[model samples]
Target: MEISVKDLTKKYKDKYALDHVSFSILEPKIYGLLGRNGAGKTTFMEILAGHILATSGEITINNENPFDNQHLIESICLIKEGNNFKRDLSIKNVLCIYSMFYPTWDPDLAEELVKIYGLDKKAKVKTLSKGMESALGIIVGLSSKAPITIFDEPYIGLDAAARRRFYEILLEEYEKEKRIIIFSTHLIDEVSLLFEEILIIQDGRLILREEADVLRHSTCAVTGSIQQVEAFSKDKKVLNKKELAGMMTAFVYCRKEEAVAEGLKAEGIPVQELMIHLTENKGA
Candidate 1:
């Protein structure tokens, strides 16, 4: 399965949500789509899922346009942040509706997850708590077993234990049958480790996209005397630098061993910190 996005642009009146974005997803690995609010992550996902059309450019799945393609649409499942179901539908009704929509839906898994989440199948959607609704969304996304499953902050009200359980199930299901899973969330620290590839967007542009492993070993935070830090950063790729009193800290895309050997305190840069370093405003 392959998803190709070439010059994908989505415009609204005078503002552009996605501006000439291009990327190809060929692997069945878990991908992390990340950005600050209004950074176009949701816009891109909507376009990819065929929920909305782009203003210009194109996105294709297996060489065919995803928009209005029933076959392709059925192969893609998107569980959004919320409002995934009608207010009057029962939990069982929602499951039944989704099971018929996806070609690869698994009923047993859905039932098991419903029990694991301790949800009453007969409960109406409007009556369920926020956490229960989120769990229902998770169940749909996971049980759909679609070729491309997109989750856009679907755990809005889930507690920590429930969220962790969802992550574990995600990994387990992925290993059982590898498929494309695009996850977007603000809680990056909790699930960053599961991302095989990470894409960071800033203000309707693609700022960075690389394998999470590469990002993990490619950057480090170094702290020491202001002069030493500055000198160390002279020849290296520094993403961000901060100074206070007589000391400086720099985030650099290079090995931390060299900085340690040179008598500076250095540690691996966290993925969340890396994303911030690459996307934060520069006082324009």
Candidate 2:
């Protein structure tokens, strides 16, 4: 299930939600789609899920277009943060309807998750709380078992424990059946370890796309006196820097061994910090 996007663009009346974005999802791995607010993450996901069409350019899976393609839509299960179910239907009905929609849906998994989440099948969707609804949405996403599963902040109101359980289940399911999972969320630290690859969008443009393992091994944060930090970071790619009490901390995209040889305190940078440093305002 390879996704190939070539110069994909989505435009509003006056602004571009996605601007000439192009990338390829070539494997069945968990991809972290990261960016700041209004960075076109949702827009790009919606376009890929066949919910909307791009204004210009193209996005295809295995050389087939997604827009208005029912067969293609069934292969992609997109669960948003909210509004994934009908407000008037009961929990059972919602699950039944989705089961019919997705040919690959697993009723046994859905039933098991319902008990684990403590959701009442008889309860109407409108009567459930925000956390309960999130659980239901996650159940649908996992049970669908689509070739391409995209989750866009689908755990909005879930408690810490429930959210943690969801992550566990997600990993279990992925390991059971390796498929393309593009996850878009603000909670990067919690799931950063699960990400096989990372794609960063900023102001509607694709900025950074790299293997997580490579970034984890290469990117470093060096902390030392101002003179030492400055000399070490002079020729390196510094993503971020700060100075406090005559000491400087430079978040750099460089080798850790080099910084360590200089006697500076160096550590691998987290994915959350990498995203922040890469997308931060350079002019400010």
lDDT of each: 0.92, 0.94
Give the alpha carbon lDDT tens digit for every residue of 149-202 in model 1. 999999988999999999999999999999999999999999999999999988
For model 2, what is the alpha-carbon lDDT of residue 221? 93
lDDT of 1 at 33: 95
Judged by whole-model lDDT over C-alpha atoms, candidate 2 comes out at: 0.94
- In model 1, the runs with Cα more than 4 Å from the true position are 281-284
Q: What is the TM-score of each candidate against the true structure?
A: 0.97, 0.98
lDDT of 2 by residue, 1-284 (tens): 88999999999999999999998998899999999999999999999999999999999998999989998999999999999888999999999999999999999999999999999999999999999999999999999999999999999899889999999999999999999999999999999999999999998999999999998988999999999999999997888889999999999878889899999999999999899888895531
Best by lDDT: 2
Instruction: Give the C-alpha miss distance for residue 126 in model 1, angstroms.
Output: 1.0
Which residue pairs show backbone clashes in model 1? Answer: none
| CA displacement after TM-score superposition, residue 138 of candidate 1 (Å) | 0.1
